[model samples]
Target: MHELIVIEHEAEAGLGFFAGWLEGAGVRCEVVRPYKGEPVPERAGDGLLVLGGAASAWDDEGYGWLPATRALMARSVESGVPTLGICLGAQLMTIACGGTVERGTAGLEIGAGAIEPLPEAADDPLFSALPAGPWRAVQYHYDAMTALPAGAVRLATGSQYPNQAYRLGERAWAVQFHPEASAGIFASWTGTSDMDPLRVADLDARVREAEPELEATWRPFAEAFAAQVAME
Candidate 1:
Protein backbone atom coordinates (compact mmCIF):
# COMPACT_ATOMS: atom_id res chain seq x y z
CA MET A 1 0.00 0.00 0.00
CA HIS A 2 1.18 3.49 -0.71
CA GLU A 3 1.94 5.74 2.24
CA LEU A 4 -0.57 8.37 1.10
CA ILE A 5 -4.19 8.10 -0.03
CA VAL A 6 -5.23 10.97 -2.30
CA ILE A 7 -8.91 11.33 -3.15
CA GLU A 8 -9.41 13.05 -6.48
CA HIS A 9 -12.66 14.27 -8.03
CA GLU A 10 -13.58 15.83 -11.43
CA ALA A 11 -12.36 14.68 -14.80
CA GLU A 12 -9.31 16.89 -15.30
CA ALA A 13 -8.54 17.64 -11.67
CA GLY A 14 -5.86 15.41 -10.17
CA LEU A 15 -3.31 15.87 -7.42
CA GLY A 16 -1.70 19.28 -7.85
CA PHE A 17 1.60 20.53 -6.43
CA PHE A 18 0.97 18.48 -3.33
CA ALA A 19 1.21 15.33 -5.40
CA GLY A 20 4.34 16.58 -7.12
CA TRP A 21 5.89 17.37 -3.74
CA LEU A 22 5.03 13.91 -2.39
CA GLU A 23 6.55 12.25 -5.43
CA GLY A 24 9.62 14.45 -5.11
CA ALA A 25 9.86 13.61 -1.43
CA GLY A 26 9.91 9.92 -2.41
CA VAL A 27 6.57 9.21 -0.79
CA ARG A 28 4.39 6.67 -2.59
CA CYS A 29 1.01 8.08 -3.50
CA GLU A 30 -2.24 6.58 -4.83
CA VAL A 31 -5.31 8.40 -6.12
CA VAL A 32 -8.97 7.50 -5.53
CA ARG A 33 -11.74 9.15 -7.49
CA PRO A 34 -15.38 8.26 -7.01
CA TYR A 35 -16.26 9.98 -10.26
CA LYS A 36 -14.30 7.18 -11.84
CA GLY A 37 -16.01 4.69 -9.50
CA GLU A 38 -12.89 4.32 -7.37
CA PRO A 39 -13.26 2.93 -3.88
CA VAL A 40 -13.21 4.98 -0.74
CA PRO A 41 -9.91 4.65 1.10
CA GLU A 42 -9.88 2.79 4.39
CA ARG A 43 -7.61 2.95 7.43
CA ALA A 44 -4.76 1.48 5.43
CA GLY A 45 -3.95 4.92 4.00
CA ASP A 46 -1.26 6.67 6.05
CA GLY A 47 -2.27 10.19 5.08
CA LEU A 48 -5.27 11.52 3.15
CA LEU A 49 -5.80 14.44 0.75
CA VAL A 50 -8.98 15.48 -1.08
CA LEU A 51 -8.66 17.53 -4.24
CA GLY A 52 -10.96 20.22 -5.61
CA GLY A 53 -13.77 19.74 -8.18
CA ALA A 54 -16.78 21.45 -9.78
CA ALA A 55 -19.23 19.48 -7.67
CA SER A 56 -20.77 20.77 -4.49
CA ALA A 57 -20.42 18.72 -1.33
CA TRP A 58 -24.21 18.03 -1.19
CA ASP A 59 -25.58 18.39 -4.70
CA ASP A 60 -25.90 14.69 -5.53
CA GLU A 61 -24.87 11.93 -3.17
CA GLY A 62 -24.28 9.50 -6.00
CA TYR A 63 -22.44 11.68 -8.56
CA GLY A 64 -19.33 11.77 -6.33
CA TRP A 65 -20.42 9.35 -3.59
CA LEU A 66 -19.96 12.17 -1.10
CA PRO A 67 -21.67 10.49 1.87
CA ALA A 68 -19.45 7.45 1.88
CA THR A 69 -16.51 9.56 0.80
CA ARG A 70 -17.01 11.83 3.78
CA ALA A 71 -17.34 8.79 6.00
CA LEU A 72 -14.02 7.56 4.71
CA MET A 73 -12.51 10.93 5.52
CA ALA A 74 -14.04 10.84 9.00
CA ARG A 75 -12.61 7.40 9.54
CA SER A 76 -9.22 8.61 8.44
CA VAL A 77 -9.42 11.52 10.86
CA GLU A 78 -10.72 9.39 13.72
CA SER A 79 -7.93 6.95 13.12
CA GLY A 80 -5.51 9.85 13.65
CA VAL A 81 -4.16 10.04 10.12
CA PRO A 82 -3.31 13.43 8.70
CA THR A 83 -5.76 14.68 6.07
CA LEU A 84 -5.99 17.79 3.91
CA GLY A 85 -8.90 19.21 1.92
CA ILE A 86 -9.05 21.84 -0.82
CA CYS A 87 -12.15 23.64 -2.16
CA LEU A 88 -14.82 20.95 -2.58
CA GLY A 89 -12.45 18.81 -0.60
CA ALA A 90 -12.59 21.37 2.18
CA GLN A 91 -16.37 21.33 2.14
CA LEU A 92 -16.23 17.57 2.35
CA MET A 93 -14.00 17.93 5.38
CA THR A 94 -16.46 20.24 7.07
CA ILE A 95 -19.43 18.02 6.36
CA ALA A 96 -17.62 14.89 7.46
CA CYS A 97 -16.51 16.47 10.71
CA GLY A 98 -19.90 17.79 11.83
CA GLY A 99 -19.36 21.34 10.57
CA THR A 100 -21.73 23.28 8.38
CA VAL A 101 -20.72 24.49 4.89
CA GLU A 102 -22.84 26.94 2.98
CA ARG A 103 -22.58 29.55 0.26
CA GLY A 104 -20.16 32.30 1.12
CA THR A 105 -21.01 35.97 1.49
CA ALA A 106 -18.60 36.61 -1.34
CA GLY A 107 -20.24 35.26 -4.48
CA LEU A 108 -17.33 33.56 -6.23
CA GLU A 109 -13.56 33.55 -5.85
CA ILE A 110 -11.78 32.83 -9.08
CA GLY A 111 -8.13 33.17 -10.11
CA ALA A 112 -5.14 34.41 -8.11
CA GLY A 113 -5.81 36.32 -4.89
CA ALA A 114 -4.53 36.83 -1.37
CA ILE A 115 -5.49 34.99 1.85
CA GLU A 116 -4.17 36.58 4.99
CA PRO A 117 -2.91 34.36 7.74
CA LEU A 118 -4.64 34.41 11.06
CA PRO A 119 -2.86 36.07 13.96
CA GLU A 120 -2.32 32.69 15.53
CA ALA A 121 -0.67 31.26 12.38
CA ALA A 122 2.64 32.63 13.58
CA ASP A 123 2.60 29.89 16.21
CA ASP A 124 0.90 27.08 14.29
CA PRO A 125 3.01 24.07 13.46
CA LEU A 126 1.46 23.50 10.06
CA PHE A 127 1.31 27.17 9.15
CA SER A 128 4.08 28.85 11.14
CA ALA A 129 6.62 28.65 8.36
CA LEU A 130 4.37 30.37 5.83
CA PRO A 131 5.19 33.97 4.92
CA ALA A 132 4.15 36.32 7.68
CA GLY A 133 1.67 38.55 5.82
CA PRO A 134 -0.53 38.13 2.77
CA TRP A 135 0.03 35.08 0.59
CA ARG A 136 -1.27 34.74 -2.95
CA ALA A 137 -2.76 31.51 -4.32
CA VAL A 138 -5.01 30.25 -7.07
CA GLN A 139 -8.69 30.06 -6.17
CA TYR A 140 -11.75 28.80 -8.08
CA HIS A 141 -14.89 28.18 -6.08
CA TYR A 142 -18.42 29.43 -5.61
CA ASP A 143 -19.17 27.58 -2.38
CA ALA A 144 -17.03 27.95 0.75
CA MET A 145 -17.24 26.97 4.39
CA THR A 146 -18.58 29.85 6.47
CA ALA A 147 -18.95 28.14 9.86
CA LEU A 148 -16.23 25.85 11.09
CA PRO A 149 -17.09 22.32 12.16
CA ALA A 150 -16.89 21.28 15.76
CA GLY A 151 -13.42 20.40 17.06
CA ALA A 152 -11.87 22.68 14.43
CA VAL A 153 -9.47 25.54 15.02
CA ARG A 154 -9.93 28.54 12.71
CA LEU A 155 -6.39 29.36 11.71
CA ALA A 156 -6.73 31.88 8.86
CA THR A 157 -9.10 34.41 7.33
CA GLY A 158 -9.11 36.73 4.33
CA SER A 159 -10.63 40.06 3.47
CA GLN A 160 -13.46 38.65 1.37
CA TYR A 161 -13.73 35.28 3.10
CA PRO A 162 -13.98 34.81 6.83
CA ASN A 163 -13.41 31.07 7.01
CA GLN A 164 -10.48 30.67 4.69
CA ALA A 165 -8.77 27.85 6.60
CA TYR A 166 -8.96 25.64 9.68
CA ARG A 167 -7.54 22.56 11.30
CA LEU A 168 -9.41 19.49 12.49
CA GLY A 169 -7.90 18.54 15.81
CA GLU A 170 -4.16 18.61 15.13
CA ARG A 171 -3.56 16.63 11.96
CA ALA A 172 -6.24 17.63 9.47
CA TRP A 173 -6.54 20.90 7.56
CA ALA A 174 -8.97 22.50 5.10
CA VAL A 175 -8.28 25.43 2.83
CA GLN A 176 -10.58 27.20 0.41
CA PHE A 177 -7.77 28.14 -1.96
CA HIS A 178 -5.59 26.02 -4.18
CA PRO A 179 -2.14 25.40 -2.74
CA GLU A 180 -1.52 22.78 -5.41
CA ALA A 181 -2.25 24.89 -8.49
CA SER A 182 0.40 25.43 -11.16
CA ALA A 183 0.53 27.49 -14.33
CA GLY A 184 -0.41 24.51 -16.44
CA ILE A 185 -3.28 23.66 -14.15
CA PHE A 186 -4.46 27.25 -14.11
CA ALA A 187 -4.35 27.41 -17.88
CA SER A 188 -6.28 24.16 -18.03
CA TRP A 189 -8.91 25.60 -15.73
CA THR A 190 -9.21 28.97 -17.43
CA GLY A 191 -9.29 28.45 -21.13
CA THR A 192 -7.56 30.89 -23.49
CA SER A 193 -10.94 31.79 -24.97
CA ASP A 194 -12.63 34.79 -23.41
CA MET A 195 -15.64 32.52 -22.97
CA ASP A 196 -13.99 31.04 -19.87
CA PRO A 197 -11.70 33.47 -18.17
CA LEU A 198 -9.66 32.73 -15.05
CA ARG A 199 -11.06 35.49 -12.93
CA VAL A 200 -11.96 38.11 -15.54
CA ALA A 201 -11.78 38.64 -19.26
CA ASP A 202 -8.39 38.27 -20.89
CA LEU A 203 -7.54 36.50 -17.65
CA ASP A 204 -4.78 34.79 -19.50
CA ALA A 205 -3.25 38.11 -18.62
CA ARG A 206 -2.34 36.57 -15.28
CA VAL A 207 -0.03 34.20 -17.06
CA ARG A 208 1.99 37.27 -17.89
CA GLU A 209 1.11 39.13 -14.69
CA ALA A 210 1.81 36.93 -11.68
CA GLU A 211 3.62 33.84 -12.94
CA PRO A 212 6.85 34.60 -11.12
CA GLU A 213 5.17 36.02 -8.04
CA LEU A 214 2.63 33.19 -7.65
CA GLU A 215 5.24 30.50 -8.16
CA ALA A 216 7.29 32.15 -5.47
CA THR A 217 4.32 32.06 -3.08
CA TRP A 218 3.29 28.50 -4.01
CA ARG A 219 6.64 27.06 -2.93
CA PRO A 220 6.43 27.92 0.76
CA PHE A 221 2.87 26.59 1.07
CA ALA A 222 3.87 23.43 -0.72
CA GLU A 223 6.98 23.04 1.39
CA ALA A 224 5.08 23.71 4.59
CA PHE A 225 2.42 21.20 3.66
CA ALA A 226 5.08 18.69 2.75
CA ALA A 227 6.68 19.23 6.11
CA GLN A 228 3.38 18.47 7.85
CA VAL A 229 3.03 15.21 5.96
CA ALA A 230 6.59 14.34 6.91
CA MET A 231 5.64 15.02 10.52
CA GLU A 232 2.95 12.41 10.22
Candidate 2:
Protein backbone atom coordinates (compact mmCIF):
# COMPACT_ATOMS: atom_id res chain seq x y z
CA MET A 1 0.00 0.00 0.00
CA HIS A 2 1.12 3.56 -0.63
CA GLU A 3 1.98 5.34 2.61
CA LEU A 4 2.15 9.10 3.26
CA ILE A 5 4.04 10.89 6.00
CA VAL A 6 1.62 13.48 7.41
CA ILE A 7 3.13 16.25 9.48
CA GLU A 8 0.57 17.66 11.91
CA HIS A 9 1.81 20.96 13.33
CA GLU A 10 -1.02 21.52 15.76
CA ALA A 11 -3.82 19.60 17.45
CA GLU A 12 -6.59 21.72 15.93
CA ALA A 13 -5.41 21.26 12.36
CA GLY A 14 -5.27 17.49 12.06
CA LEU A 15 -6.03 15.83 8.73
CA GLY A 16 -9.83 15.62 9.28
CA PHE A 17 -11.83 14.59 6.19
CA PHE A 18 -8.76 14.69 3.96
CA ALA A 19 -7.33 11.66 5.78
CA GLY A 20 -10.55 9.73 5.25
CA TRP A 21 -10.60 10.62 1.55
CA LEU A 22 -6.97 9.56 1.08
CA GLU A 23 -7.51 6.32 3.01
CA GLY A 24 -10.60 5.58 0.96
CA ALA A 25 -8.46 5.96 -2.12
CA GLY A 26 -6.08 3.31 -0.66
CA VAL A 27 -3.30 5.44 0.79
CA ARG A 28 -2.06 4.83 4.31
CA CYS A 29 -1.16 7.88 6.38
CA GLU A 30 1.42 8.08 9.17
CA VAL A 31 0.94 11.31 11.07
CA VAL A 32 3.83 12.97 12.91
CA ARG A 33 2.89 15.37 15.69
CA PRO A 34 5.84 17.67 16.24
CA TYR A 35 3.79 19.83 18.58
CA LYS A 36 3.82 17.06 21.19
CA GLY A 37 7.60 16.56 20.94
CA GLU A 38 7.63 13.93 18.20
CA PRO A 39 10.76 14.37 16.15
CA VAL A 40 10.32 15.14 12.47
CA PRO A 41 11.82 12.27 10.52
CA GLU A 42 14.39 12.84 7.79
CA ARG A 43 12.33 10.65 5.51
CA ALA A 44 9.58 8.07 5.68
CA GLY A 45 6.81 6.52 3.55
CA ASP A 46 6.00 6.88 -0.14
CA GLY A 47 4.75 10.49 -0.06
CA LEU A 48 4.61 13.54 2.20
CA LEU A 49 1.61 15.62 3.38
CA VAL A 50 2.24 18.74 5.42
CA LEU A 51 -0.88 20.22 7.05
CA GLY A 52 -1.72 23.83 7.97
CA GLY A 53 -0.76 25.36 11.31
CA ALA A 54 -1.26 28.47 13.46
CA ALA A 55 2.41 29.43 13.21
CA SER A 56 3.85 31.40 10.30
CA ALA A 57 6.20 29.57 7.96
CA TRP A 58 9.17 31.79 8.92
CA ASP A 59 8.63 31.34 12.68
CA ASP A 60 11.19 28.58 13.05
CA GLU A 61 12.19 29.88 16.47
CA GLY A 62 8.65 29.62 17.83
CA TYR A 63 8.03 26.24 16.23
CA GLY A 64 11.28 24.34 16.61
CA TRP A 65 10.27 21.57 14.19
CA LEU A 66 9.76 24.00 11.30
CA PRO A 67 13.36 23.91 10.05
CA ALA A 68 13.33 20.14 9.85
CA THR A 69 9.90 20.19 8.24
CA ARG A 70 11.10 22.68 5.62
CA ALA A 71 14.17 20.53 4.95
CA LEU A 72 11.95 17.50 4.47
CA MET A 73 9.74 19.46 2.06
CA ALA A 74 12.77 20.61 0.06
CA ARG A 75 14.06 17.05 -0.18
CA SER A 76 10.65 15.77 -1.21
CA VAL A 77 10.53 18.24 -4.08
CA GLU A 78 14.13 17.52 -5.06
CA SER A 79 13.53 13.75 -5.18
CA GLY A 80 10.17 14.05 -6.97
CA VAL A 81 8.23 12.47 -4.13
CA PRO A 82 4.47 13.03 -4.32
CA THR A 83 3.78 15.82 -1.85
CA LEU A 84 0.91 18.14 -0.87
CA GLY A 85 1.21 21.26 1.27
CA ILE A 86 -1.86 23.04 2.62
CA CYS A 87 -2.08 26.62 3.96
CA LEU A 88 0.90 27.06 6.25
CA GLY A 89 2.35 23.95 4.70
CA ALA A 90 2.14 25.69 1.34
CA GLN A 91 3.91 28.75 2.74
CA LEU A 92 6.66 26.53 4.09
CA MET A 93 7.03 24.92 0.68
CA THR A 94 7.17 28.36 -0.99
CA ILE A 95 9.93 29.64 1.30
CA ALA A 96 11.80 26.32 1.21
CA CYS A 97 11.90 26.44 -2.57
CA GLY A 98 13.05 30.06 -2.92
CA GLY A 99 9.61 31.66 -3.09
CA THR A 100 8.04 34.33 -0.88
CA VAL A 101 5.28 34.42 1.75
CA GLU A 102 4.01 37.35 3.81
CA ARG A 103 1.09 38.62 5.83
CA GLY A 104 -1.71 39.47 3.45
CA THR A 105 -2.43 43.15 2.86
CA ALA A 106 -6.09 42.34 2.19
CA GLY A 107 -6.47 40.97 5.72
CA LEU A 108 -7.53 37.48 6.78
CA GLU A 109 -9.39 35.48 4.15
CA ILE A 110 -11.74 33.52 6.33
CA GLY A 111 -14.87 31.45 5.56
CA ALA A 112 -15.80 29.95 2.19
CA GLY A 113 -14.14 31.80 -0.69
CA ALA A 114 -14.12 31.40 -4.45
CA ILE A 115 -11.11 29.84 -6.25
CA GLU A 116 -10.74 30.05 -9.99
CA PRO A 117 -8.64 27.54 -11.87
CA LEU A 118 -6.19 28.97 -14.34
CA PRO A 119 -5.69 27.69 -17.87
CA GLU A 120 -2.66 25.67 -16.77
CA ALA A 121 -4.81 23.69 -14.36
CA ALA A 122 -6.39 21.87 -17.25
CA ASP A 123 -3.08 20.04 -17.65
CA ASP A 124 -2.35 19.47 -13.96
CA PRO A 125 -2.28 15.93 -12.64
CA LEU A 126 -4.49 16.71 -9.64
CA PHE A 127 -6.41 19.81 -10.69
CA SER A 128 -7.38 18.84 -14.22
CA ALA A 129 -10.41 16.91 -13.06
CA LEU A 130 -11.88 19.68 -10.94
CA PRO A 131 -15.06 21.43 -11.99
CA ALA A 132 -14.78 24.22 -14.47
CA GLY A 133 -14.81 27.90 -13.48
CA PRO A 134 -14.75 29.11 -9.87
CA TRP A 135 -15.41 26.91 -6.84
CA ARG A 136 -15.75 27.57 -3.13
CA ALA A 137 -13.18 26.44 -0.55
CA VAL A 138 -12.57 27.01 3.14
CA GLN A 139 -10.02 29.78 3.65
CA TYR A 140 -8.59 30.91 7.00
CA HIS A 141 -5.18 32.37 6.51
CA TYR A 142 -3.59 35.67 7.49
CA ASP A 143 -0.51 35.01 5.33
CA ALA A 144 -0.37 34.36 1.61
CA MET A 145 2.16 32.99 -0.87
CA THR A 146 3.00 36.19 -2.66
CA ALA A 147 5.44 34.46 -4.94
CA LEU A 148 5.93 30.92 -6.13
CA PRO A 149 9.18 29.03 -6.73
CA ALA A 150 10.95 29.38 -10.03
CA GLY A 151 9.43 27.22 -12.80
CA ALA A 152 6.34 26.49 -10.70
CA VAL A 153 3.12 26.08 -12.63
CA ARG A 154 0.32 28.28 -11.36
CA LEU A 155 -2.79 26.13 -11.16
CA ALA A 156 -5.39 28.21 -9.36
CA THR A 157 -5.97 31.73 -8.09
CA GLY A 158 -8.24 33.45 -5.58
CA SER A 159 -9.44 37.03 -5.50
CA GLN A 160 -7.70 37.84 -2.23
CA TYR A 161 -4.58 35.78 -2.88
CA PRO A 162 -3.34 35.39 -6.41
CA ASN A 163 -1.09 32.44 -5.62
CA GLN A 164 -3.70 30.05 -4.32
CA ALA A 165 -2.34 26.85 -5.82
CA TYR A 166 0.74 25.83 -7.75
CA ARG A 167 2.86 22.83 -8.69
CA LEU A 168 6.58 22.69 -7.95
CA GLY A 169 8.70 20.41 -10.11
CA GLU A 170 6.40 17.53 -11.09
CA ARG A 171 5.06 15.90 -7.95
CA ALA A 172 4.92 18.53 -5.24
CA TRP A 173 1.80 20.71 -4.97
CA ALA A 174 0.89 23.56 -2.64
CA VAL A 175 -2.44 25.22 -1.80
CA GLN A 176 -3.27 28.19 0.39
CA PHE A 177 -6.78 26.96 1.27
CA HIS A 178 -7.96 24.24 3.67
CA PRO A 179 -9.40 21.48 1.55
CA GLU A 180 -9.08 19.06 4.46
CA ALA A 181 -11.03 21.12 6.93
CA SER A 182 -14.46 20.01 8.09
CA ALA A 183 -17.07 22.44 9.32
CA GLY A 184 -16.30 21.45 12.89
CA ILE A 185 -12.60 22.04 12.43
CA PHE A 186 -13.28 25.44 10.91
CA ALA A 187 -15.65 26.29 13.73
CA SER A 188 -12.98 25.35 16.22
CA TRP A 189 -10.59 27.72 14.54
CA THR A 190 -13.12 30.57 14.69
CA GLY A 191 -13.81 29.86 18.34
CA THR A 192 -10.21 30.64 19.11
CA SER A 193 -10.19 33.76 16.99
CA ASP A 194 -11.10 37.26 18.15
CA MET A 195 -14.03 37.62 15.81
CA ASP A 196 -17.40 38.67 17.19
CA PRO A 197 -19.70 35.87 18.32
CA LEU A 198 -22.34 36.75 15.71
CA ARG A 199 -19.77 36.87 12.96
CA VAL A 200 -18.35 33.55 14.07
CA ALA A 201 -21.80 31.98 13.98
CA ASP A 202 -22.40 33.30 10.46
CA LEU A 203 -19.08 31.94 9.26
CA ASP A 204 -19.74 28.59 10.89
CA ALA A 205 -23.19 28.43 9.32
CA ARG A 206 -21.79 29.26 5.91
CA VAL A 207 -19.19 26.51 6.13
CA ARG A 208 -21.81 24.05 7.32
CA GLU A 209 -23.95 24.98 4.36
CA ALA A 210 -21.04 24.62 2.03
CA GLU A 211 -20.01 21.24 3.45
CA PRO A 212 -21.54 19.21 0.63
CA GLU A 213 -19.98 21.36 -2.07
CA LEU A 214 -16.66 21.27 -0.27
CA GLU A 215 -16.83 17.49 -0.17
CA ALA A 216 -17.80 17.26 -3.83
CA THR A 217 -14.94 19.51 -4.88
CA TRP A 218 -12.11 18.48 -2.57
CA ARG A 219 -12.72 14.74 -2.19
CA PRO A 220 -11.65 14.10 -5.75
CA PHE A 221 -8.72 16.45 -5.29
CA ALA A 222 -7.60 14.47 -2.24
CA GLU A 223 -8.07 11.18 -4.03
CA ALA A 224 -6.11 12.46 -6.99
CA PHE A 225 -3.19 13.23 -4.69
CA ALA A 226 -3.49 9.74 -3.23
CA ALA A 227 -3.43 8.23 -6.70
CA GLN A 228 -0.28 10.21 -7.51
CA VAL A 229 1.38 8.93 -4.35
CA ALA A 230 0.39 5.37 -5.19
CA MET A 231 2.03 5.69 -8.59
CA GLU A 232 5.44 6.30 -6.98
Q: Highest TM-score: which candidate?
A: 2
Global lDDT for candidate 1?
A: 0.75
Question: RMSD for each model, in Å, please?
Answer: 2.5, 0.8
Candidate 2 RMSD computed on C-alpha atoms after optimal superposition onto the true structure: 0.8
Error of 2 at 72 (Å): 0.2
lDDT of 1 by residue, 50-147 (tens): 88887888876546478777887888778777788888889998988888877766777776777888876777766776666687777778887877
Question: Where does model 1 exceed 4 Å of error?
Answer: 192-201
lDDT of 2 by residue, 92-144 (tens): 99999999999999999999999999999999999986777598999999998
* lDDT of all predictions: 0.75, 0.93
Which residue pairs come into collision in candidate 1? 99-149
* TM-score of every candidate: 0.88, 0.98
Best-fitting candidate, scored by lDDT: 2
Clashes of 1: 1
